[model samples]
Target: MSRVSRRRFLEDSLIAAAIAATWAPSRAESEGSLGRKVGPNERINIAVLGVHGRGLDHVKSFAKMKDVAVVAIVDPDSNCFEKAVKAVEELGKPTPKTVQDLRRILDDKDIDAVSIATPNHWHALAAIWAMQAGKDVYVEKPVSHNVLEGRRMVEAARKYKRICQTGTQIRSAVGSREAIKFIHEGGIGTVYLARGLCYKRRDSIGKLPDGPVPQGVDYDIWLGPAPKRPFNPNRFHYNWHWNWDYGNGDIGNQGIHQMDVARWALKKNKLPNSVISLGGRFGYEDDGQTPNTQLAFMDYGDAQLIFEVRGLPTPDLLGVKIGNIIYGSEGYVAFTSYSTAVVFDSKGQKVKEFDGGGDHYRNFIDAMRSRKESDLTADIEEGHLSSALCHIANISYRLGSPQPFNPRTKAFGDDKEAYETIGRFEKHLAENGINLNEATYRLGPKLVLDPEKESFVGSAEANALLTREYRKPFVVPDKV
Candidate 1:
């Protein structure tokens, strides 16, 4: 057997043993709602990283849990430290711990678990390090910035016998599980295609000439594993969700959630055999590197799935509904972001509809105490697979030629048919209010990819982006 496979097998064996040894009865497993349990609060000492944005939600949720205590909060931004300190102080509990460095938090042997809400680039590294430090991990979605990092995280978790959960909170929703179960059980008979959509409006990320570091922000540390670039406020805070260096556009940010649900209902654990993606920034002119509007199709032999993202304000998109639809042989299942799901037959008659609402953090804490990874409705592997699908689409779009559609044929004709392809891309952009005439588009041409190898087939430029150059002293080693 290969070294990696051998290592994986041994790690799996160790994890199995750990699970068996640490088994504890969970009230939720029997009594439904997770409530006060037996013993002296047996609270798990926890530290949270990236306590800004969604990080605050993690803290608030964990604080309400009977068996979990927020022991520390870490963030590179001093502003976040101040906010987190106030939050912990308001909890009516003693000031637990506070730090600006994650390394210090990880080094503290007293911490039993960690919740990571850092940017996409930091997800995998933080999780892997936490696992190595013998702490269970709860990492936010789009679990890795790239494919290899996610695989590495899974390996590290297994090797260290850590209970790791991905923050695709929707999976734990009672309604979500029921919807998926119904679809799998033939409510959506012979499911052929699962479609996901995100149609949220976003403004420009400013046109400020990039320069100067912001006060109280460690811009250098923030760019640890990513290539250094001029600091721009447009590329910080929520705006980071749009940049290629720090984010995966809406696909990884929001679309991944619905994509996750689709994959779960479909029970797929690997990438599709073939993929085709098209679209670009169609509305507002922004500093974002990824497409503002895009469509991706994945061919999975017997079935296919499509992922669509519209960052622009597109009217009547997805039949005037913004959510996911699973088209099956007999019926379809539709889910809204509000956690509402309904099944409709070929006749367009509604058959079943339900609401999925619940607390995600409570579920993770329950699973942690039970020592059963399966108890996690959305496991790390599941999140990785869904996120990988999004990554594949983005990668394909980056490699594919800018093709314009021919109105007569209603199909795209690319550079091979240069005139027709360019026409289609141009027309599509114009229809969506993008002005190609205003400026040049930095478009990438089509290239072959070998997903198994995690590299481009013949393109050096494309392959170079697969992994980033890390800064000195903050680098994530090639091998742990």
Candidate 2:
């Protein structure tokens, strides 16, 4: 296995550290100068990347914003442009130039910013390239495919002094904001635990035969940052979430949002002291490589964060699925959705409710206009911390086995609880008609971590999974 070298890391950071000072894009580079240097009232030109799915929303959102123009729309698939352009025109905005190549779009100086909704693998590299090209960025959730990439992304944003927003919209949602604020104000009386649920319904993709690359799809560019392999439907588009090559499964896909909120509730800004995970892909066998049902546990010393992703049907945790529940000494809060939250007494009776909503895209624009990274609703730093948790959990599972952890030290040295957690997880899969005798669950070790360094203590194999071998040209530079 290829290990990331310190030399590469130093090389990338040195170059990127000076990019902001020397490479920041100027108003003169804009393709359309708006007849004057861009001022407070001038429209900011932006490019929307990956229109095949979430990028479509990005195209339309920017189109409706005041003093914003969707100048370019990018996608590897040419077919996505039709709908993206139609969405822009229907909103009364001028048609944006549709280009299939992202690097080509990065070359245009007219573009002030780019909103990226590409698959998990392309997120970090795209944002880095955009910032290196002097453009602000708005990237989607689990901002990187792995831990190292996420940290690199944060570096690129800070070093370049570029405004990069992670698409964890709840950070900007009024309801979630108010609820978390309440917890911070002693409404929840010293929050002690947070549970993130991602019980999104998922069915098996089932196995499919290898196939020819689809027409108009630049398969090479689409596989950017990930290793090249035989083309298969299961590893493309949304289904890519199930593969380690391109995605971090549901936890990194949907659970990162809730996990962010969980960490935010605890008021922690760094990695946990230790992390471990247990579970397996249940239901049916398929091309999917990621576990459909999994549980992650993180210890923060004073508190704990737990997250569960149930791809199969299951009852809601604390009356909510796909959200967060923060427990405190006095009461608990249920962040049910992006725009809704509920507070309950220790008796479990509803005591208060909150409902508010805001636009994350608009928040990014506000920060960009003000040239203040602090104004961002979901800053890149916040995105990196949360996404790293998903990576840590995955690393444990990928190289773990059932083992005991020290109760007093809370380090991996004993195994009763680990066995119990795995047993329950096995029961869960069995209820879904999955026989564990044929395929037992993988239980990860309790990997102690230096929250500051973000590495597994004394475990080289675990650390190696923190970064992947990048393909040429599309590589996520170690320095950046």
Best by TM-score: 2
> Candidate 1 lDDT, tens digit per residue, 313-383?
55533352467888899988888764778888898898888796988788778777876788887778887
- Full-model lDDT for every candidate: 0.72, 0.83
Off by over 4 Å in 1: 1-41, 316-321, 407-465
lDDT of 2: 0.83
Best by lDDT: 2
- Per-residue lDDT over 433-465 for candidate 2, one digit per residue giving the tens place of the 0 to 100 score: 775556666677878898889888998998899
Q: Report residue 137 deviation for candidate 2 (angstroms).
A: 0.4
Candidate 2, superposed: residue stretches over 4 Å from native: 1-37, 402-427, 435-439
Model 1 / residue 30 / CA error / Å: 36
CA lDDT, candidate 2, residue 404: 28
What C-alpha RMSD separates each model from the true structure?
10.8, 8.2
Score candidate 1 by TM-score against the native.
Answer: 0.83
